[model samples]
Target: MDEFEKIQKLIRLKKYETPGEQFVDEFVTAFRERQRAEMLKQPALSLLWESFRAWYDQLFSPRWTLAAAVVVIGFICGFAFMPRGGQTHLARRGKAPDHPAMTLSLGKDQTGKTLPAFSIETIRVMGEIEIEPDPGLLSKHFTGGYDQIVIVPHDEADTAIAVPYDFIHLDGKPDIR
Candidate 1:
């Protein structure tokens, strides 16, 4: 016998049962029907839903959201502790009462003449000043025109004795000096 005839005879003898063609056709039909039904259904608010999900995801992430919160807290704390322009605790406590009105006259060294204007204000002395008379100007004027002014608290009256020049000296250190 030929190879093809022999193979066909062996197949017939085995009597193997194959799946019904109707089963495959039914499965394909059902799959197509389900796909058509889903395609026909309307999606409500799909665009809005997608946008909301994207925004929600970004806001919940640690990097951007946590940094924004920290910056807001820093600004609040900065404003709370910042000092106002004219209100200072150190000036209020250590300011000279009488000499609150103090002035320093700045003038030309070569000429004995005083300048037209000068500054007068409260002195807040924190340290000592060494006064050496300007020899060049002393011949023309008895007192040195420009002298360093030292400001100290009013209660440190005894400490004021260290300064030499009369024109630039405080009258007396306050008890609270």
Candidate 2:
């Protein structure tokens, strides 16, 4: 077609798709309304994910990028220098404890098959070992002559002296009884 005819055809197509006076405003309003409705109707997990995405996007924004970086670096350095639980008390001071204080004995069931257990060992707490404490409660659990057991008063063991409770990942059947 000639240039004029081509222009006419293009204009005819554009006429049907012309931007309405409130096109931007209407679109924005509908978008915001849909977002609000979706947020209201979304399940908890979806809301959490959306919130996380928003926070993550905010973290990358110019206003928050530097603050987020500083916070991240601070966390990294803090964790890097922190004392880990596996490091023995003596080992932290450049000396390894003699005869590993605590050792794990993989337990076997009465059928002599490996099963689950918290830990079976001489749990070394800060005190002397008592071989069969209190003759009255001595033969309480086992019958084959009580082996040595360590007992610590609650007041002593419950102290807040930097115990690595969270780091105790050694899996064994918890001594529930």
Candidate 3:
């Protein structure tokens, strides 16, 4: 009538039967044999490789093998039959070919005679470009027309000479000669 009583009644009615000892022994032996067989079987990778080899062998039968062989033979024959000779036309200039031709000779120390990448004057101009002129100096030297001016540093003394109306400003203007 109660839950516990019902459970007890069910437990009593239920057959708690187990297999015979011989049957249990035979089942465990069969299970162990199955496990041993599984352990002895090839790994998945080896099985997959063997299957791939079989598939490849089936795919490339006698016909495919003959076609591949023919392709290789054709390539070999093509290379063997290729023409070998001087393809360039030569001009017979009566003069014998000279070793180390005079035309190929270069002037000695050509770089020494060449002009520098930037002259001293060019460097001076660049130096002037970087200098921010004194606002008082700018007010005195620069007028409304010229926004920029170049200050020349005279080597005679350590004095920097502000060239009036000669400096280059950010505003577009022709070079003051």
Measured by TM-score, the strongest candidate is 2
Better of 1 and 3 by lDDT: 1
Output the lDDT of residue 80, model 3: 76
Indicate the worst ten consecutive residues by lDDT in candidate 2.
124-133
Off by over 4 Å in 1: 1-56, 86-113, 118-177
Q: In model 1, which range of ten residues has the least summed lDDT? A: 123-132
| Model 2 Cα shift for residue 31 (angstroms) | 2.6
The global Cα lDDT (0 to 1) of model 3 is 0.45
* TM-scores vs. true structure, each candidate: 0.25, 0.29, 0.23
Candidate 1 C-alpha lDDT tens digits along 48-97 = 68678999787688777788889999989976775432223344455544
Ranking by TM-score: 2, 1, 3
The TM-score of candidate 1 is: 0.25
CA shift at 152, candidate 3, in angstroms?
18
Q: Can you write out model 2's per-residue Cα lDDT over 20-129, one digit (the tens) per residue?
A: 78999999999999999988899999889988999888768866788888999998997687544333334334433233222223345569886432323222223222
Q: Where does model 2 exceed 4 Å of error?
A: 1-26, 60-91, 94-177
Cα lDDT of model 3 by residue, 57-81, tens digit: 9999989989999999998997677
On lDDT, the candidate that comes out on top is 1
| Candidate 2, residue 82: how far the Cα is off, in Å | 19
